[model samples]
Target: MSGQPNRKFDLALTGRRGGNVWTIDGEPYPDANPLSVQPGDHVRVHMVNHSPVVHPMHLHGHFFQVGDAVQDTVLVPQHMGEVTFDFIADNPGDWLFHCHNLYHLDAGMARVITYVQ
Candidate 1:
């Protein structure tokens, strides 16, 4: 086993009418909960739309790549597709991840990701 640890974390978010209910390891993170991350880690966000409609996802501060070095404001089509994106946790800060729907944000469909020092 390598002394240096390579960690992979999966974040699952559900898209609904109001907002997203996020679960990390099957537990809900309360509103305004501090999102802590570490450097040299890989993050995989598996966004699933449980709603009858579609939602577009965005990750702020960190421009991510999906299969290639392309900027994506991806729309998760209803009941069909799941958009997956990965990023290297290089920058450290409180970053926002949420749906691009204005009303959805108004409805509280947002969360913060914080990289610890």
Candidate 2:
């Protein structure tokens, strides 16, 4: 996001054995570690996938600019693949950001974006 995002987050996606925990930034789901933002804030998420599997990242409550298109979900290929998306935090609430893959999500890959006052 060369437009200079007001809020920036770097997320890394990976998987851990023994419970098959799908992790974001190296932690399981219900991480309780939310990304805080304000309404109208320009947010950018730079995501990198370290696993050898594709991940379709989804953001609830807002559409994001990926490449030249605006969509809520974008795919990040495996093996160090990266994706950068930008969005305006217009919705006010706690939204989930996670992999669209039901299995990965059920395993533990997710985060909450909390809109703070």
Off by over 4 Å in 2: 16-19
Residue-by-residue lDDT tens digits, candidate 2, 37-95: 99989999999998888999999999999878999999999999999999998999999
Per-residue error for 41 in candidate 1, Å, reads 1.5
lDDT of 1 by residue, 60-100 (tens): 87766666655646776766567776766788877877668
Candidate 2: residue 102 lDDT (0-100)? 87
Could you tell me the TM-score of candidate 2? Answer: 0.93
lDDT (C-alpha) at residue 55 in model 2: 93
TM-score of each: 0.71, 0.93
Candidate 2 local lDDT, residue 16: 40
Model 1 poorest 10 in a row by lDDT: 1-10
RMSD for each model, in Å, please?
Answer: 4.8, 1.8
